[model samples]
Target: MDNVISVILGGGRGTRLYPLTKERSKPAVPLAGKYRIIDIPISNCLNSYLNKIYVLTQFNSASLHRHITRAYKFDNFSKGFIEILAANQTIESMDWYQGTADAVRQNLRFFNQPNIDLVLILSGDQLYRMNYQEIIKEHIRTGAEVTVSAIPAERTQAEHLGILKVDEQGRIIDFSEKPKDEKIIDAFSVSPSVFDRHGIKAGDRTLLASMGIYIFNLDVLNTILKETRKSDFGKEIIPDIIKKRRVCAYFFDGYWEDIGTIKSFYEANLKLGSPSPSFDLYDEKAPIYTNPLFLPGSLINSCKISHSIISDGCFINDAEIQNCVIGIRSIIGKNTRIQNSIIMGADYYESASHIRANRFKKIPNIGIGDNSCIEGAIIDKNVHIGENVTIKNANNIEQLDAENYMIRDHIVIVPKGSVIPSNTAI
Candidate 1:
């Protein structure tokens, strides 16, 4: 609705995804090689015919902000755009947003429309695709003050999520934020017939965990924020209002992944190449959009590729690749092999004599000698491996330089734009 506004919570330290997020915010982390994480929600909004978006974040948001500006350029003359609402300490009582509620509270000034009916709040780092219109329909039908989109989770996983107890009418009767052991012991496994595939269980004690998506009537949202007087929906806001307010649950079931961890992120990327992935970005219904690179079609140069989502303008020559995502304009040397890894993560390309994996630990020295062999690693942009360099786990250091790179949990991270010395070991 033109009278509605969307707020995306993008603020988080994202310390868990250290090296990847070192120079960028979580939302800014590149997804699908070309699109950033924030594009998922923005694309959802655009496809669902929702406009007016505000992204909230604090740490290293420069890249995220730049991408948002460059990617989201709808018809400004009408009423479609994506905006980043960063943390600002304009008020004497102001500080950085401490929690979710606090983040939205800090940007209340953006909600200036008297006609605005609902505020759609979402998380920026999740990997999924959905139509928000359906959730909005449920929200209006229930006449709820706050409607949360929830999905079924494993009982053990539910312990770490903000769970909901919804009545037959789909109205949330109880809400608990990341409940403890005994509190969720009696959790029910809702019957398949209890609710449709949205993973909604309209059963007794069948706790549904919130997916961090909320739809609130603007007035009710303003009122709740006023009443709570504290930041964060889980810690202060929602938990405090459920007793005195009508907060409902909207169940959603399709596919979603919060790729906030390096392992999860890597796993999610590999899943994209699976025979049947949990999340599919190529869906025509809700296609994900990002800043257009306008690159040409990707070309595989007689290379053997088992399973990889190679984007535009890629060249492969007698190389072996499996379970990897190759971005645009990336080149693989003849006879080089890549397996179970992400490569050329950024959109860059330049003709190099030889480049291969397993050099992530070593300096990214190009000019690899003819007989060099490499494997099992991540390669940063524009690295040159000298000719005849061998990189493998069997080598004596099993780890490499700290000045240009560092190994975290066995994942080699090459700092951006560092050249590896030839025959580097130890």
Candidate 2:
């Protein structure tokens, strides 16, 4: 459990996220106001007391690197360190990583270190709180070459994941990458028990979906890297090698989400505004770690809040905020109304204005004018909304200034420092 080296894959192009991925890697995408995508995995490693970590990233890794340096600075006593292994090709291989396995094969220095027994492979794009200690113990006890962290998902949902099939002894008997064959009874289900508990028919019991998290022995990782000819581990390397190796499955029933697309990112953030979110960050046993900052709790200025997460340095005036996350130093003006939205960083709402938007994290600092109304929009950093602006309507999709601004979920994203004119409608 203690002698483990975690390697997080952070090399996704995030094509579905488009503009959001335009500036940074998928793992660097801004999450829940104050956190980034890579924070989840790093926090897990920190909380689990696993010190040595290597993040494999190449696509837009600048922001990701900066964040890691600031967020994860190891202490002298802990000696645990988080390092970013960005892609750097030379004469031997002058190309970016083609797949997950290729990323690790390029950075073989991780396994070269001493005193590392287990290699923990994880996805940097997921949001969840987990303890790797349990999975490590299972891997060690099983004496298997590889141990995969799996979950029960539905047949339809398994299409988005690497579905698996294991025998009674928990040995991985089959592995398919989003196979569409219905006759395949050994397919993985997203939540078999959930459907069974909810009275839904047992669509597929062999539907063991892989969470892309694996625990491997240091020698096993090195051997796999040497034997593997492909770039990706899941789609190519792992599945190909499983034929001659001992592969087992470790079931994970905790809250896990993959923020790989715009829709998924939006939905995942909205989940935080739920009455009782499935993902709990306040757990004492395994706390999510973040860089400390000095700030007071949120201040509601005679406002009415209905299910929202307000961080420190927020001042909500006599307004109504429902299902929105107000970040630090955000000042909601008097008589303002925000609903089912995300307010991140520093936001300023003037008096008598109302807004309803998803992914409000675009703007690091934004100010809405008085008597204005915005809907279903993604306002970028340092944006200014004039009076009487109509961003979203019944259509729920707006295509404006996309050449200048990035688009996520069809929301009109005003770029940083953008100022909207009066009587404007995006």
lDDT of each candidate versus the true structure:
0.72, 0.70
- List, residue by residue over 275-355, the lDDT tens digit for candidate 2: 789887667887676655567777776778887777777766777767766555565555566665555544334333233
* lDDT value, candidate 1, whole model: 0.72
The residue ranges of model 2 lying beyond 4 angstroms of the native Cα positions read 185-206, 346-365, 398-418
TM-score of each: 0.86, 0.86
Number of the top-ranking candidate, with lDDT as the measure = 1
Error of 2 at 20 (Å): 2.0
Clashes of 2: 22
Give the per-residue Cα lDDT of candidate 2 at 142.
74
Q: Per-residue lDDT for 425 in model 2?
A: 63
